[model samples]
Target: MMQMPELLHSQKNSLFTAMNRFIGAVNNMDQTVMVPSLLRDVPLQKRDPDHGSYLRDAEADMYTYYTHLKSIRNEIEWGVLREDQRRKERAANTAVNAANLEAEGEDGNDLEQLLQYHLKGLHGVLAKLTSQANNLTNRYKQEIGIAGWGQ
Candidate 1:
């Protein structure tokens, strides 16, 4: 089993720390999955029944998810979204802006409340990403018939 590097005490609660941990997990997954083709056609949720609800609507193969994970890592590392993501973001923003225009009045605490909400959601997302990366690495080891891998 691989262990992630320890974060500094000051960085423990920051968004960067969470993202860094997620990146490390994905890097481990990328290194472990040397033969990406081995992941082709494999379902993401078959290994754990509890994880099915995490991506209930996704039927994409493991290779698709592997590439997606790499793309997410790249996005986080480069601090830039892919064109498709940017497009989606633009659409979502337009809708959000329209909604905001419709509801004009807001207290000063709204910004803090919104920030807290997003921060909590970001932490949840980062944790899920880390778990997915670790799971993929383990699954890759299993696919290669590694015996007693986690023992």
Candidate 2:
């Protein structure tokens, strides 16, 4: 029911807010986890069935997640992807576009619908990223026996 301008403005605001929160969370995690070595061999708690299970290597999972969060933070700050990631993303996008073209027949609302779908997905991902960064920070503290300092 929103006018075009209102919808655009709202979407932009939500996206920016999510991005900023994620960046801040990652920055806090980076500052907190000074010794990545300590993250080695640490295992994250098992998630609820609905939330999905972690099949990653428990010994390296925390370190990997830590590095990934920082990488995402850097990408967001720089507004660019690493070459390998960009290449993979381009290939995925091409496949998705081809599928969409074949499935969606020239609906006037297609582009708008696609944009909204992606925006919603992006928002969910950002929120999850922020939570992960915070969790990593908290877990690192616990690993080093500094539990309950900044939960």
Candidate 3:
């Protein structure tokens, strides 16, 4: 029995791997790989409207939206990694300062302020990414006749 954290980690890794493959397929503009890859993971409902077997008409648009979303997500992931590194650096610096006792008067508030600013920016970027991804996914669902299971 996997622990909750282990399961979550596994899920996250799987999602990232799938997204990476999807990104590669989009970058190569290989519809043969991209279409089947996406459709294989997304199960079709019997009640879904017949928008053609492979949802052929919507594939191009969906790919465009998905690629744009992938770019946004990349940016967000970069921001998060940057913030995490900054946080670790800040903690290490604070620990060093505590050990020194001499730099206490110099004020580490500036570092804290900068970290807060970066975190806020990262938060904004992530929020925008989420919104964009959600919008694109919903649009794709609608176009492919998977929005609500039925026409």
Query: Could you tell me the lDDT of residue 42 within candidate 1?
Result: 78
Candidate 2 has a TM-score of: 0.68
1-151, model 3: which lDDT tens digit per residue? 6579978877654545544544443333332222424533342222225553333333344455565656655653455457778899899988897877565554578768877787666555555545545544554456556675423
Weakest 10 consecutive residues of candidate 2 by summed lDDT: 51-60
TM-score of every prediction relative to native: 0.68, 0.68, 0.38
- Candidate 3 — number of clashing residue pairs? 0
Q: In model 1, which range of ten residues has the least summed lDDT?
A: 48-57
Give candidate 3's whole-model lDDT.
0.52
Give the winner by TM-score: 2 or 3: 2
* Model 1 lDDT per residue over 1-151, tens place: 6545564554686788889999999998887888999898877764446665545326887898899999999978885977899899999999997788569765668868988999989989998888888888887888888835655
User: How far out, in Å, is residue 55 in model 1?
Assistant: 11
lDDT for every model?
0.82, 0.84, 0.52
Question: Which of 1 and 3 is the better model by TM-score?
Answer: 1
Superposition TM-score, candidate 1 onto the true structure = 0.68
lDDT of 2 by residue, 1-151 (tens): 6579978788666988899999999999999998997776676564566768644454556877788899999989996867899899999999998888778765659878988999889999999999989988987888888979864
**Candidate 2: which pairs clash?**
none
Which candidate order results from sorting by TM-score in descending order? 2, 1, 3
Global local distance difference test of model 1: 0.82
